[model samples]
Target chain A: MSASDDIWILGISMTKFGKHADRDVVDLGAEAITAALADAGITMNDVGVFAAGNLMGSAGIAQQLQKQIGQTGIPAYNVSNACATGATALRTAIMAVKAGETDIGLACGVEKLAGAGLLGAGGQEKSVGHEWTPSGRYGAVGPIDGRIGTEAMPGVFAQIGMEYLHDHQYGGTAFELFARISEKNHSHSTLNPLAAYSKAMPLEQIMNDIMIAYPNTRPMCSANCDGASAAVVVSGEKLRTLSLEQQRRAVKVSASILTSDPFEQACQVLPNINTLTRNAAEQAYEQAGVGPDDLDLVELHDCFATAELVHYDNLMLCEEGGAVDFFESGAPWRDGRMPVNVSGGLQSKGHPVSATGIANIWEVCQHVRGEGGPRQIEGAKVGLAHVIGLGSACGVHILEKSGLAA
Target chain B: MSTATTIPFVDYLVLEPEPHLIAHECTGCGARYFDRRNACAGCFATEFRDVDVASDGIVRSFTIVTFAAPGVEVPFVAALVDCDGTSVRGNIVNCPPDPEHVTLGMAVRLTTVAVGADDNGVQAVNYGFEPR
Candidate 1:
């Protein structure tokens, strides 16, 4: 196998994604990293590099983690790419292994938002700073702009939902479809032990919930929490040297692609769907030599109910304006064809920003290894994980059961 | 006696009572940007010219924001307006921020309003798209 094809994910682990008032970001990160190491049947001594992701933390986080896990004098990188930090870190590890730079590499993502003074009361922190304006390096429109008055995240997505509904011909009302998406994810969360909300919410309750924004109630939005997730990747040669049991459980990293948005003058006004996500997903599918039809499941960034609906089309899983039908066909359910977000996604799984991307990978790895207990897609062999950040970066990774190909 | 002073909220907003937004237009590709551009992203041209964006446009998408940062009032319409051939993001004012009042394709005109006043009695001015 080529070096690119030789990269394999040996283990994955994540903390229960929710408001961990008692834990620091570092503690959450260490717990996940330690769990991942144990799952890989290895120790920190065996890890050649550590790539850590955090958005609202100080620098030297990777070094801090290294100190806690016993400093091995290995090079550690601290990655920050808004919400896609985890996936960016994971891609760094994949590159390291693909380039023969390391036999074993670790990628980790951690975030602590609760009581971090990040969101401040009234959700005013949602406003975009002047530095993020069109003149900035990460030039992309934000959910809220201070000069334009505080339009929070829910409001931003609500606009997209309304426009999408008006522009498309759907069998159901936009509100109903949004509620359905929320209800579906909540139902899927019931089976995920690590999910923050495991109880199935009725469609009525979701629709009737307190409206944070027009057409978007509180239930339609992802919760801000504290959590971490980590994964260990190794070269294919290293995988072959492992025990038969380990080899049997290994998952191959078929593709890891990341893309950023091109400079656009009118990003928000031009259909709220993410162009970067489509670009990244296309590259990932090509790199993996697999199409959307061949995948067993997907774990996408569902930051809001409308986001999930928009992504169904952006990922090319269905035709444009066909997401409502796709959901109505029961295709996105756990047992349905091409199940999505069996982990409840960010909606019910809890979105701790940086941790979210790694959490998606953890869920996909579980499915690929046939380890997803009640939520498993039976006979699942191939899966996709996708995440997008607002500073506007998108990451897509495809994984297949080891020994299934090549 | 206190005298009222006015200042632009952002450098891009022209402070005339009947104000209009300005954009940096690329000489090569005609791509317009709200902020100053060092280079054109469309045609990679180093030359640009300041152009006045048309004040009238239709609402492409809108939302009523009920939650916001401190000091900003709730239930305001945040909209993306298509002005002439370019798209601009701003708040839709002079109308109730609700589904009944803020509909798609609503015609809006660009106008300036006071955002806040400093301790020195200087009124900070910001621009928005109002019902035409």
Candidate 2:
């Protein structure tokens, strides 16, 4: 693609990921969008299109946000793809700009999930106290999630982690290995001031915390919090018309790819999380004309420590069946060869559902622009941001400092 | 004095004379599914036929859940059993939910459990696996 056809992220911002009891969905959305607009030195009137994503809120979130921010009367899109909702929303804006439909596009994601305990399996909302009638799909026993098997995120990811170890023949210390991964992410959180829980958790603490599942503990899971993230995207050609300062700080959108589960018999019921992510990674690398080795940093969906271990393989950061060895080598630590989740990841940075995807990208964008504060990876150039939602959607975005940019 | 009619929790579960699972096997790709699927996930074939899943299987993967949402009991063994190449997700019962009792590749058999009953004397039955 020509430089004129390329899409670039001109500005990005994310709210401190934590409990915001006084804030509602629109409040957070407006805050993120306004800040991102100011970051790019632009206003809502400059945006040709708007996209917004939210999980628990009603439809037309983009329209609602416009009422609070500024109603430019541009085409507004509301997107949701489980946890990848934010990335999907951002992609909508990028696609619009790439298609010449817009010169500047705005995207934002927001969510408020404070005090919302163990997130339920999406799709199965067991009727609470509703009299069990003998006429439905299950006859009388509702969709068996907790009763028989587990559709719960913790149990599912725990099983996914164990299955990877069992499949790879990593035994004996498999549980401890997972705990160590959590410890690394929690430690990384200490450098990230915006993280929800920036405390460094000892390995023993993570292992001894309330065991949500066999291999995963409470500390190893993503913190349920509220926050928002937004970004402004512009066509590369249009970006040249902006101020030199804005043009110099713009991050090139090297690639953006989304994938869903392909038919796999073994994990049909559980939904294969690996293949989709690998597919997205492959596509992203090919699109960016770069390999995993080129990434200076990454912010992947570490909803659970178990999920993070498998993603190392899924993201191709390690060779096939090399995830265990990769961790043992400490390559994923912040100072390691390939630092993964330098911003504490979802475990401590907090996962606000729809906001997580863009927040991850924001983390990468910050480092690429040499503005990552204390957690910055020195001279970081290329970065990858990834998020996977259990409806089986995976989004991978590769970003880099444009050659023409500072 | 009341009469209780026991019903299988899910339609695919059979409890008459013996406990077994019925899978919706795709005619095109031979893929099996415990729940009713409109089309085959593998080949997208709209044809399906019921096939009896083996009552005996080996535990492929298992997790001992120790924490759960309110009102739901924890410390249970949730396992994915592979029966004759068909994957069945269910709980492991009649044994402790720990490493000593439940293990990967352990032999198990299908068993039925009475979940609960309603005011009209209707008992709901769910399926689980037990160490053989």
The local distance difference test score of each candidate is 0.80, 0.88
Candidate 2 Cα misplacement greater than 4 A, ranges: A1-5, A121-140, B1-4, B120-122
Interface RMSD of 2: 3.0
lDDT of 2 at A200: 96
Write candidate 2's Cα lDDT for A109-186 as tens digits.
Answer: 999988887786433444545434554544535656667788678888888887787688776676799899999999
Relative to the unseen true structure, what is the C-alpha lDDT of residue A291 in candidate 2, on a scale of 0 to 100?
99
Per-residue lDDT over A235-338 for candidate 1, one digit per residue giving the tens place of the 0 to 100 score = 98888888887788888888898988776667633433467888888988998899999999999988889788888888888877787788889999988887
Report the C-alpha displacement of residue A342, candidate 1, in angstroms.
Answer: 1.1
Every model's TM-score on chain B = 0.90, 0.93
CAPRI classification of candidate 2: medium
The runs of at least 3 residues in candidate 1 whose Cα sits more than 4 Å from the true structure, single-residue gaps closed, are A1-3, A115-151, A166-172, A268-273, A404-406, B1-5, B15-17, B116-122
TM-score per candidate, chains pooled? 0.90, 0.95
